[model samples]
Target: MPPSRTSAAAQSANFSTISVTFLGTASAQPSSTRNHSSLALCFGGRGDTWLFDCGEATQQRVQKSDVKMGKIRKIFITHTHGDHIFGIAPLLAGCLNGAGGMIDGMVDSRMEPADPKELTTLEIYGPLGTRAFIRSALRLTHTRLDGRYVVHELRFPRDPPGGDYTTLPPHRCELPGKNLLQTPMDDVQWGKGIWNDVYADDLVTVSAAPIEHSVACVGYVVNEQPVPQKMDPSHYLPHIKRNKAPIAYLSRLQRGENITLDDGTELLGVPKRAGRKLVILGDTYDPSPIMPLAVGADLLIHEATNAYLPGIDPATNNDDTEEVVQARTTSRGHSTPQMAGRFARLIGARQLVLNHFSARYRGDDDVNEEAKTVMDAIKGLAEKEFCGEVVCARDFMTLHVSR
Candidate 1:
């Protein structure tokens, strides 16, 4: 049997921490220190891993990091940028073939789940061209999978994938290569600039909104569902003793199941406690459109594509200023550290983790490199705008967000 997935009731009081690990944090291309843009959001409570972008050589990064590829259940792509998505086909092929120690990864079971129509499918969510990109890559490369994949594309009225009309939104019927599911984001599925409830399960509800980027880019907001409240055993203990109730009742109650005692006294489960919300944006100059869902986020992971470190940045000169850096970064549809911080402050995020650093900035693996100093200075820039805990993300760095 598959490893038992923790239910919301079972994980109620566990309130375990969720870990966000940066697999690659480089912008545009790979440097010696950074790969590209990709991160792993691992939920300890659920035993599931979700990847937010799959840049080139991401599988290599996964091999090096503590993250287990076997647990990756879903992947969310920000846009159709090559650097943000080049690793997808290889990762999927590996999972389906169970090669390279990925034996337990989400695989093809052939057997249907509890639901009769259930297909052991890997789900991928992204922008308009995602289905075309994946299908073409998998098809052109002659890469086959034992299992199937479901691609959900957020369609924009103004933006559609150029040169790929066959795989465009309002998806065609499933092709037999292995039954790919392409579901289009319809009018009912969207608002002015937001795609509400892009995905949701027992643990979390994910939403997406358009951000200002050169391409049709969107950002995601993951709001964890409230867990059942901590059990107040004292209240039930008295009644249990008085009624000589079975000890098993306590366990059931802790699981948030209402129990009727021998005396016919009914005990209601404790109220649920609110969970945390996390906002993670893609390459963007401005992300104000998603403010409604992102306000008061517990954690915000924003891109910091360029910085104005005079002594460190290769582009920075004596006459260079943050304003100059901001203009250049925004012109390319990317954010600087200060821009990220300002957005974090607008959302009232408690913690800010900045990612997608330029190639000039080094990564954390080399302690002797300028990464330590450059990252600290970058974090300071964001901290100036957002009065929260600011962090400069490095490849393989993990941040734990407590429930």
Candidate 2:
């Protein structure tokens, strides 16, 4: 078990290893065991985190767990639905206001003020207009945050030089303006490559692809780089036998170097082993577009709200007595348990973690069983196709992605 309280960097070693905590997993409404819908994906070594969604109770979840809210450098809002992003305003405030803010006042969390010169801006990435929504909410609430923040709109037809161009099948270069003038464009290209990232000394890359959903919802693929495997001390045994200076040189050698000493002595070409890879998807009903991108991900965190109620029609069936909920789920655009599992198996994730549940299912027992049922169902179906580990995620749960 991971320590209850620990620094983000201290939580794990490799960037290939990820700590994913589900704050809320319910659809639309809040439940005792599950809140709305939110997840924190902590990429180890990188010290950078990505939030899949921010539900209303997300702040409470962060306060109760070891996750550092201030460390959440990036957030991706899947859609504008209330359940997905209702908690963002408060979450941002909790980090910005330090000890006097929402969570600070509630949980007594502290912030060791950093020098102004060293502060890095918090980046919020989401669908088009998400920034506007957050700005409006902050303005209306009269909430003030101390840190610097910038919102980048993940809009369609991304800025030129990052968009698509078609070519003729005859291997001829088709000019952008003339090709579409006479013919209908059948193939539409999506995605603006993987997002290049650098957080402190850590590096990460993100890619986005359009998924089938009711509205304009896209799924994100997070590829985290793990810390380089620990250097074998035995490799530098001779250096330790020499002197302290040689040992210091070994440290540099482990950092991928061909070391040359002041006296012309050299330890040439010491190559460290490569690190692990972790892949995560925000939310997707269809698994096709994201498969290649998610290929060979050591760990894959996908939505599980739909995983429990396998084959149970969300349209005609809901445990809630209210009839509106049954119709709301599909109309509002959310996946079911079986749907989530199917996608995971299709994508070929080495391990599948399911999160984001419906409010109708409450209590740890019921949710766990529901999740088990879905995983079992998927396992039964996938036995002939694919074999991988599947898990039902709970709040504050940590797993070793690279272990």
Candidate 3:
């Protein structure tokens, strides 16, 4: 016999899923094999999607993938670096045109005009100068987004506030008749002062912290919110019906509130399901500031722009011995593979995904031999350092996050 409706609902509620797609994984510049840095996060239950770091041709990458451009509600820019943010304006323009059915002046004859209420406003969050950068880009391109793009500029605390870092008040662009953008600054306190809650909703909470890099850059952590457990109706429906429980009582029970039936019997609600945590880092030399956020994360997506020399043992080598390589990456404001792995190990991340490879490692002419060697070495180091699964990120790669 088919399962009852309540039983199915209960089973469905037992799991929560999130997926991350690597749209671009190259560093600084696009290579024959990879684009720049971009990724998409999709929530399975709500069908909500977010973009992180829209690099050059990110829209094209999205087009080639299964992601729907119209469904992207938020874009998070890690910094003002061109490779990290150059694609924002074009992507926005494309999204606007696509949603309004103005693609190449070819409109669907039977389609009605898009409802203003149905229009999706894209919220962009980034560091200081984000608004100016976006504004300048739009103005120079003569692209009028019709106030559909809302920008949120995050501010970091002046100096270290004793413990960690903190964010100053964020500047938000207001829309007509409604404020669609909300930040997690209010929800998260100035703990250790290193990280600030940037975005939070019923489904997830996102936090950001500055990392050590050439310019001002930030990394983000996404945490899924605990959902109320589903109660099997078959287990309680008969008792509830026999007791003639009111609709209000049933609603309260579903909400995990204790409810007393007319027969003076009490029903306990099911516990909530545990949520998952994901961390995505920008270009950084030192990831220590956000180490707390990375701790216990289910997935940690970090940049591995450089790799160790083939014969050098990272554990045995001293900083002085590797000064040249260190200077190269640090001067360019990037991280080495060993750095990424060490960070993941320190945090005890369950899974580590390394991306943003430097162009020097690209071996397009030789069928990616040099690149594969670098990636293999990085994976080897990471495997030795971290106890979890390690993966080298490639463009269009997707991973499912489930709990």
Candidate No. with top lDDT: 1
> Candidate 2: misplaced stretches above 4 Å?
1-17, 43-50, 98-120, 158-201, 233-245, 260-274, 307-339, 366-386
Please provide, for model 1 over 1-403, each residue's C-alpha lDDT reduced to its tens digit, 9 standing for 90 to 100.
1111234655434437788999999999899889988999988856778999999989889989998877787888999899999998888776555223222234334322456344335678888777778876765554545555677777675654343435433211123221112233344433455677777656777888888899988899988887677677888899999998887788777757898887899988776777889988999998987787799898999999999998766668788787987998899999999999998988889999999988888886348556687888898899899888988888889999976
Give per-residue lDDT, candidate 3, residue 210.
73
Number of backbone-clashing residue pairs for each candidate, in the order shown: 0, 8, 6
TM-score of 2: 0.68
Candidate 1 ranges with C-alpha deviation above 4 Å: 1-15, 98-120, 159-164, 167-191, 243-268
Clashes of 2: 8
Which residue pairs collide, candidate 3? 164-192, 164-193, 164-194, 165-193, 165-194, 184-198
TM-score winner among the candidates?
Answer: 1
RMSD to the true structure for each prediction, in A, is 6.3, 11.3, 8.4
lDDT of 2: 0.56
Which lDDT value does model 3 have at 168? Answer: 26
Among all windows of 10 consecutive residues in model 2, the one with the lowest summed lDDT is 171-180
Q: CA lDDT of 266 in candidate 2? A: 69
